[model samples]
Target: MRKSDYRKLGGIVILLVLWWLLAYALNRHFLFPSPFAVGKVMLCQLQNTAFYQAIIMTLSRCVIGFVISYGTALVLALVTGHMKWLRDYLAPLITLLKSVPNISFILLILIWFNREISVMIIVFFVLFPSFYSSFTNGFDAIDQSLREVMILYPQSLWRQIVKVELPLLKPYLAASYESGIGLAFKVGVMAEILGQVPDGIGKKLQWSYLNIEMAEVFAWTIWLIILLVLLEHGLRLLWKKRKE
Candidate 1:
C-alpha cells in the first residue's frame, strides 16, 4: 500500500483503540461492548444459519423493490418526457410522493399489505420519485438538433433511443441507480423492522435491541453498512466500465 493508505489504516486503528478504551471505562455491556467483543459476536453470528437467511431475505426484498422502482421510473419518464401535457398533469402527484415521509408510507403500507410485502412496497415508492426525476432530466437534456437530424434520416425509434437518448442519459441514469439502491435498502429495512418480518436483518435488529443485545445490534448495523458499501462500489465499477 501507498503511504497515504497506511496513514489511513493507522488513523482507523487509533479510532478503534479509543473506542475500546471508552467501552472499558464505561464497563456496561448494555451501554457499549468493547470492539473485540463486538467483533467476536459478529463472527459468531456469521456461523449461524439464521444469519445468512436474514441477509438473503432482506436482499431479496430490496432487489425486487429496486427493480420495480427503477422500471416504473423509466416508463414514467418516457411517457412524461414525450408528452408535455402529461408532465404538467402528473407533476404535483410526483412531487407529493417525493415529499411524503417514508415512515408514513411504511405505516400506511403495513395497514394495507402483509408484512413481507409492505417492506417491498415501501422501498419501491420511496425510491420512485428520485429515479423519475433523474430520468426526466436526462430525457430533457436530449439534443433537439440531433433529434431533428435523426427524424430527417427517418431512423427507427429504437436506433435513435440506443444511439442518442442513452448516451445523453448515461450520467442521470447512473446517479438515479446509485441513489435509488441505497435509499431502497434503507427504507425497506426500516419498514421490515417496523412491520416485524420474521426472517430479515431488520427483524433481527429489532430483536437484538429489545433484548438489550447491544453488540448484536451493532453487528447487524455494521452488516448493513458493509452491504451498502459493497453495492456502492459495484455500481461505481459498472459505471466506470460503461464509460470506458
Candidate 2:
C-alpha cells in the first residue's frame, strides 16, 4: 500500500482505540457502544434479509430523487443561462428553496404526501437548488472566446450543447454529483425517519433509537458510513474513466 494509505489506516486504528477507551470509561451500553459490540450487531444485521432490503429501498428512492432533480436543473440551467429575464424571475424561488429549513419542507411534505413520496420529495427539494446552482455556475463560467467561436461557427443548438456546453460543464457536473449524492442520501434518510416510512434504513434507525438499542443504532450508522464510502469510491472510479 501507499504511504498515505498506511497513514489513513493507522488513523482509523487510533480512532477505533479511542472510541473503545471512551466506551469502556463510560460503561453505559445504552449511551455508547464499543466497536466490538457494534461490529457484532452489524454481523447479525448482515445475516438478516431486511437489512439489505431496507438499503435497496432507501438507495432506490435517493437515486430517483437525485436523477429528477439533476435532470430538471440541467434543462433549466440551459434555458435560463440564455434568458436573463427568466433567470431573474426564478431567482427568488431558488433563494427561497435554498434558505428554507429542511425540517419545514419535511413537515409540509409529510402533510401533503405519503411517507414514501414525502421522502423522495424532501430529497428533491433539498438537493435541487444546489444542483441548479452548480449548473448555472458552469454556464456562467464558459469562456467568452468560446462563446464568440460558437457564434462564428454557427453550429446547430443541439450540436453546440453536445460539443461545447456539456464539455465545459463536465467539472461542475462531476462536482455536483459527487457532493450531491451523499447529501441526497442523508436528506432522504432524514425524511424517511421524520415521515416514519414503513420500510427503510431510516425506519430501522428510528426503531432502534426508540427501543434504546444503542448497539443496533451504532451498527446501522456504521453500515451507512460503509455504504457512503463505497458509493464515493465507485463514483470516483467512474469519473476517472470518463476523464480518460
Candidate 3:
C-alpha cells in the first residue's frame, strides 16, 4: 500500500487503541464508550431509515447553503476585485460578519426566522466570508501583464473575464471548495443544533447527548467524520478531473 494508506491505517489503529484504553480506565460505558460499543451503535444506526434521512437532510442543507454563499461571493469578488472604491463599501460588512460570533448570528437569526430558515441562514453567514476572501484573493493574484495583453486583443472586460480571468481562478476555486466543504459541513451542523432543526446530524447528536447515550453520540460523530472524508475525497477527484 501507499504511504498515505499506511498513515491512515496507523492513525486509526492508534486512535482506536487510545479510545479503548480511555474507556477501560473510565470503566463506564455511559460516559466514555469504547470504540467497539460505538461501532455497534453505528451499525444499528446504519440500519435505521431515519439515520439515512438525517444524513441526507444535513447534507442537503450544507450543499445548498454553500452553493448560495459560493455564488454570491464570486459575484462580489468579481465586482470588488476590480473596483477599489467598492471594496470600501463591502469591507466593513464582511469584516463584521467575520468578526462576530457564530452563536450571536444563530441566536439573532433564530429570533427573526423559523428553525429551518435560521439554520440555512447561519450556514450561509458562517461560510460566506471565507469563500469571499478566497475568491477575492484569487482575483487579486491575477497577473497585471495578462490583463494588459487582453487589452491588446480588443476584447471587452466581460470577455476577458470569461475567457481568461475566470479560467485562471478555476484551480483556486476548486482548492477552496475541496477544503471549504468540510468547514461548511461542520458549521452547518452547528447551525442545526442552535436552530433546533430536526432530522439532521446535529439534532441526532443533541438528542443522543441529552439522553446520556454516549455510544450513540460517538457513533453519530463517527458517521459524520466518515461522511466528511467521503466528501473530501469526492472533491479531490472532482478537482483532479477539472485540472486534467
| Cα RMSD for candidates in order | 2.0, 1.1, 1.5
Residues 23-128, model 1: lDDT tens digits: 9999997779888888999999989999999999999999999999898988888878768999999899899998998888989999999998888888888988
- Taking the tens digit of each residue's C-alpha lDDT, what string does model 3 give over 1-244? 9999999999999989999999999999889999999888988887899999999999998988888988898888998877989988998999999998878887888889888767777778988998898898899889889878776877887987788888989977887787778888888888788778999999999998789998998898888899988988887887778779
Which residue pairs in candidate 3 have backbone atoms (N, alpha carbon, C) closer than 3 angstroms, thus clashing?
none
Shift of residue 121 alpha carbon in model 3, Å = 0.8
Sort the predicted structures by lDDT, highest score first. 2, 1, 3
| Best of the two (1, 2) by lDDT | 2
Which of candidates 1 and 3 reaches a greater lDDT? 1
- Candidate 2 is scored at a TM of 0.97
Q: Residue 212 in candidate 2 has what lDDT?
A: 94
Q: What 10-residue stretch in candidate 1 is worst by lDDT?
A: 155-164
- lDDT by candidate, in order shown: 0.88, 0.91, 0.87
Superposed by TM-score, candidate 2 places the C-alpha of residue 241 at a distance from the truth, in angstroms, of 0.6
Where model 1 places Cα greater than 4 Å from the true spot, the runs are 1-11
**How high is the lDDT of residue 24 in model 1?**
90
